[model samples]
Target: MVWGLTPLFVHQRILPVECWYPFDEKRKYVYETLYFIQILAQGQIGQVFGNGSGVYVVLITLICGQYDILFCSLKNVLYTAEINSGVSAELLRGKQLAVDKEKEELNQYFVSKETFENLDNLDQRLVKRNLRNATKDALNECIRHHQGIVKVCTLLEEFYNPFCLVKSLQMTVQLCFLVFVSVNTTASVLKSLNLAQYLFMTLCELFIFTYLGQVLKVQSLKTADALFRCDWYLLDLDIRKNLLIFLPIAIRPVQMTSAKFSGMDTQRLRAILTQAFSFFTLLQSLT
Candidate 1:
């Protein structure tokens, strides 16, 4: 029962179509890979991940390629949500500034025209600066009221932590096995080619995950910059302190991990590819 239902079960329960729908071609890896996977499923082919790739090269090629595309599709979509929300916050800040300027201009009519003209140039400059800062402070308060910082952070952490752990485990196993296959001189040409294809897919997936993780980190840190950009310097000490409450947390970067341990960044991805290639070279030399 489980064998017959594996494809449907994985699609409905594990990998939904909606996950990949939001991503563009740039974000979605290798559309042909997904197509091949579906073809393998429809043909009722034998398992690909089994030890006997030499006996089932066609099935293995389709299976590995398809699963690779499936896995990488959502790495960007998951974090894009947080990034968009942060951008919206920045836009709100700019709008608030514009509204405050209009209000100040409206209030200027109350000041007597003679009194405003009589002020010295230096005093006028200082008064203008004070008005601008005060307006910004009020606007920052409104921005803070609307921010969902806690909610965004919580959801990101909850989703990223466990997802990377499972991916790391699965990739680790695939990497080890691929290396083993590469070293086996007795392996058929078709077997070697299938292993190489799978290795390429694995590398692509790792690159996608780490790249998206880095993007997420950068986007989250930009929120901190947005917070600091506010006119906290001119507000009263008490009000300033409130504005600063979330600033420190915002400044701290958000990161996704590989297996709940090491950070998933481009640096790590480079190391992985380097090591995989180096090992492949060593095995070739031995052969």
Candidate 2:
């Protein structure tokens, strides 16, 4: 039952890694999780780690689901790092190119009428004129890269929106069940690693998704500052106006959520913990 439903809930990501980062697009992927329940769907259901019911039927899904979310979070963190490096590099490179072009332009126009005649020889003036003629370029690579980063964030929100919703629903039901088992079969539940493992896996899975989204949001906010530091004033007037488009995006910020319920972050994680305990308490009181 869990096997078939996993993929429907998973949705992977919208744009593959290649679409977001050049390095990721170029590098071949290996040892990556294809979906949430690959092993179980491969006829390993009754035989996860060569164990049966109290283990196989339960632990495999819990552990695999936990692992899937964790792996996704780790990849997201790495991807964000690549994005930061790319953004920084492109911003600096474009600024330097702008500076070089500015120097060449300065050669054509007098820095000041007094300073131009003070040059020792024509060769000094010639270098600036020749370099200006040579450095003729109009480009803003940073904007394109920022667009890519924004796309990644957009896709991430799309991919994980459904994921967090389904998982929240799944966890609510799963935790309620765990609370029941822990209440009614306290000794048996304590004795079995499988049962305890399920609880641990639930918390860990929730932590990874919420925390990763939170970090992504935090980093996305930093891009605004990165954009400001990119020497936009030095860019051509047209280019500077075009660069202003990023300002709105940065100010509003990028974020992911659990079905629009809340921002996925440490606060969300804390709320989940509180809800779990509250659920456990409500369950205990009823019993």
Best by lDDT: 2
- Kindly report which residue pairs in candidate 2 clash with one another: none
Assess candidate 1 and give its TM-score to the true structure.
Answer: 0.44
lDDT (tens digit, per residue) of candidate 1 on 168-224? 566656675588667665754544565677787776767666776665556555555
RMSD in Å for candidate 1, one decimal?
Answer: 18.9
lDDT, candidate 2, 152-218, per-residue tens: 5566567667666766666666777776786678543223445567677777667666666665555
Clash count of each predicted structure: 0, 0
| Model 1 spans with C-alpha error above 4 angstroms | 1-150, 186-192, 230-238, 270-287
